[model samples]
Target: MKITLIIPTYNAGSLWPNVLDAIKQQTIYPDKLIVIDSGSKDETVPLASDLKNISIFNIDSKDFNHGGTRNLAVAKTLDADVIIFLTQDAILADSDAIKNLVYYFSEPLIAAVCGRQLPHKDANP
Candidate 1:
């Protein structure tokens, strides 16, 4: 399947590299990695641009809307068989994460799937 991954990024803080690295390390790398950056003041754009299979589209921070921005990213990929949306800070826990997610699509009745999200290790319990 042609999987396209989309991530909405702002500053994305200090965890951006880890997020990108995790995606890069996935056993099933996305066919396309779309990054919609909203006028970040950090290295988010440059760092993503340096990676392969990533395409970035710039938008003003003032124009960012959670749902609208994501819809726009989806529109950019008309040929994708599966579209995966993610936040810039989401780091895949293992190499098989994407592979495992994609495996579910083999079932004819499975229309969509969501991966589990865990709290940050540093977050207060």
Candidate 2:
């Protein structure tokens, strides 16, 4: 099954690279990686451009709406059997995190799945 991963980014900040690294190391990678950036003034766009096989779409900052931006990316990924949406700051917890999540779709009754969030090592309890 074709899987597409979409991430909507603005000013993703310094941690964005780490998030992208985690995705690059995933055991089961998506067939397509799309980044919809809304006029970031930082390095978000250039950093994302460094990655190979990534499709980046830029929109005016004024035009961004949380749900609308996601829908915009979805429109371009209509051919994918599975579409995964992630926030810019969310880093996958492990190499198999996505693989584990995607496998659930194999069950005929499973329509959606959510991943558990673990606090970062630097996060205060």
Candidate 3:
């Protein structure tokens, strides 16, 4: 399946690199990576923008919307069998994480899937 990943970010800070690295290590790397940034003052934009497989886009922070911006990113993809959405803070737990996400589409009847999440060690109880 042709899968594309969309990540939306602001001031992603230090966690973003770990997120990117984890993505690169996935057993099934996305065919394309699209990052939508709302004008971050931090290094988040440049960090992802320079990556070989990532395409970064800018929008005014004031114009950010939950569904709207993501829809915009989806519209940019040439074509994809499946589109996976991830936030900058979502670090994949293992290489199989993405592989698993894409696996569902193998079923001819399954058109989409959402991944399960486990709380990070730093989460407050």
Candidate 4:
């Protein structure tokens, strides 16, 4: 099974490295990693470019927004069997997170599946 992991980022330099590290630690690595960047002023672009398994999409328009950027990234991987949309600040709690997500899709009737997110120590509702 193959999955396309799409991460929408904007000035996420402080958090992206953690996200990338979590991705690398996944027990089942995604077939493709797509990073949709919205004109980051930090080293996000350069850092993403330096990653071996990641593909970066730099959206330079001043009007770039998360919704639009995510739509564009999804459009680029329409052929993928599963699209995993992740935020730049999100980290996989367990190594099998991706495997569990893909496992849920084995059911023929399942069109989509979402998992519960544990509250981050630094996140506020």
Q: Quick one: best TM-score, which candidate?
A: 1
lDDT of each: 0.91, 0.90, 0.88, 0.82
The alpha-carbon lDDT assigned to residue 36 of candidate 3 equals 94
Q: Give the TM-scores of the predictions, in the order they appear.
A: 0.95, 0.92, 0.92, 0.88
Q: Higher-TM-score candidate among 2 and 4?
A: 2
For 1-125, candidate 1 gives per-residue lDDT tens digits of 99999999999888889988998899899999999999999999999997778899999999999999999999999999889988877788899988999999999999999999786775446
lDDT at 74, model 4: 88
Specify the highest-lDDT model's number: 1
- Residue 13 miss distance in model 3 (angstroms): 1.6
Which pairs of residues clash in candidate 3, taking residues 3 or more apart in a chain or in different chains? none
Candidate 1 deviates by what RMSD?
1.3
Cα lDDT of model 3 by residue, 42-104, tens digit: 989888865657888899999999899999999989698889999888899899898998888
The alpha-carbon lDDT assigned to residue 83 of candidate 2 equals 89
Better of 1 and 2 by lDDT: 1
Candidate 4 lDDT, 9-117, residue by residue in tens: 7888576777777888898888888988877898777777755567888777685787888889988887789989988778788889999999988989999988666
Clashing pairs in 2: none
**Model 2 residue 84 CA deviation in Å:** 0.7
